[model samples]
Target: MQDSPQQPGSTGPTGSTVTSVDDPWVPSALEQERAAYRSARTRRSALVATASTLAMLGAVVALVGSSPGWPRVKETFFSWGKAVDSFPAVLDGLWLNIRVMLVCAVLIAILGLTLAVMRTVRGPVAFPLRLFATAYVDLFRGLPLLLVLFLLGFGAPALQLSGVPNSALFWGGCALVLSYSAYVAEVFRAGIESVHPSQRAAARSLGLSYGQTLRHVVLPQAVRRVVPALMNDLVSLQKDSGLIAVLGVIDAIRAAQIETASDFNYTPYVVAGALFVCLTIPMARFTDWVARRQGFHGAGGHL
Candidate 1:
């Protein structure tokens, strides 16, 4: 029997099935491209993740197994006698550290504020001020902290200058102020620049003086923007205080070194490490808190 005539719009020889339209299996060019892109991305991501994992594992193994010193460090920690008896010296050193940090922070703020303002000032009248500030910042920032301390300590006596006393405490504190002020000056400058230029324009339009505008409008906002970064820099400054040991400052590390020298045991150094962590942890936490409070913006909002 002859087959029934094909219905209108049905798939038959006269009505060729347009594969692009009729076949659900066929995909559009754009959709196919997107699918291929997704597949490639997923495969690439997998490969990268696997490689990273392997690298991390290798690093961990190398750090734990290949290093010869970690066992001795661990053993030192296990022995309580050496660390326990040196606790008094460590506490005294920590006290000195607190005093040094406090004094240096104050000096840095004063000096850095002066330098930052000088550098940003306008006109030929302030040319020497700008140059002086620039030279001071560049010189102190370039020199190593230990060398700076040595000059301030040993060289000062020859010059009949008593800025840094015979006490290492005096020299270490001065060194910190000198070194960190340069860095903080840069921070302050960035903060000042971050203020919108229009604010100054608006202030000028209102017949405000340059100083007045900066003091009232610009500086307030800029300081808020830079608080988080300032906190980070302060934390870094605290860690670098360890370099003061070169000046014979009996800071935590230096005290530990003395104890190590006397007893031939490395336990005191471990204690010093722990003390450094104790001192630094608060600063670290403060930085995190400040950053969060500032809405996690980039340093000076440049991000």
Candidate 2:
């Protein structure tokens, strides 16, 4: 028996099929050519980019290696022996930095959200809270983080107040929370305000109390919108966690410093810096990924 006639939308010989009526949508020859062109162009662009990047990096390496001071610089800053010796100590200390960053990040998010809510709450009754939050944000944001760390890390212990833990690490972490929270609060506030006044109005119209509306609607959106910013802050927090070393804490930087003091070789510091870069870069890339996932265009390309 002969094959049944081709049904509409079924596959058939192109010569026998009515292209428009008998077949599903297919790329026209022009469209096919355009797609091929695009693919070739993308490959060519990638190849050019790879070559250019390798060339630029090679030039930088050659330039640096050929400099007159390269030998001394290498011995001082890039000694392989020093790096190997310091790696374990620096790695151990970096674990401390990571823990401090994680702890401070949690506290910062909580305190920052609280401050943002306080500043945004609507009512005469909340005037005092708003004032306090505003003053706190302004004061902390204006102060340099290092100065705040010094004041808290040193002066707080000097106070010797009742029921106070005078540990440098404790106070240094507190200073980090206080300073970073101010900045994070502003980021949160921006996210909160970006939610559009209509969202609050709509939630209230649904008989939701201000707190409920904020918790159910405004906050979720606000937090989602600010995630990329928050991640960036965490990245900074990871690096700055090293500053706790100033308070006599034996963090990564301090460990490197100790290792360097033996021969005044800066290699340990370089090792510490390389470790920080390794950690920070992934966080930075993750932030960009988050931005892209959320349809945000970051400064570095299309995120």
lDDT of 2 at 165: 91
Q: With candidate 2 superimposed using the best TM-score fit, by how many Å does residue 219's alpha carbon deviate from the native?
A: 0.7
Supply the global lDDT for candidate 2. 0.92
lDDT of each: 0.81, 0.92
RMSD values, in order shown: 9.5, 4.4
- Candidate number of the best TM-score: 2
Count of residue pairs whose backbone atoms collide, per candidate: 0, 0
Candidate 1 structure quality by residue, lDDT tens digits, 1-303: 999866545787766843334445668899999999999999999999999999999999888766888778666554589889887897788777777777787788888877888898889999999999999999988998878888886665566555535666676677789889998898888888877789899999999999999888877887787787788877777777777788777887788888888868888888878888887898899888878867746444432
Q: Write the per-residue lDDT of candidate 2 for residues 31-102, one digit (tens) a residue.
A: 999999999999999999999999999999999999999999999999999999999999999999999999
Candidate 1 segments exceeding 4 Å error: 1-73, 76-78, 162-166, 296-303
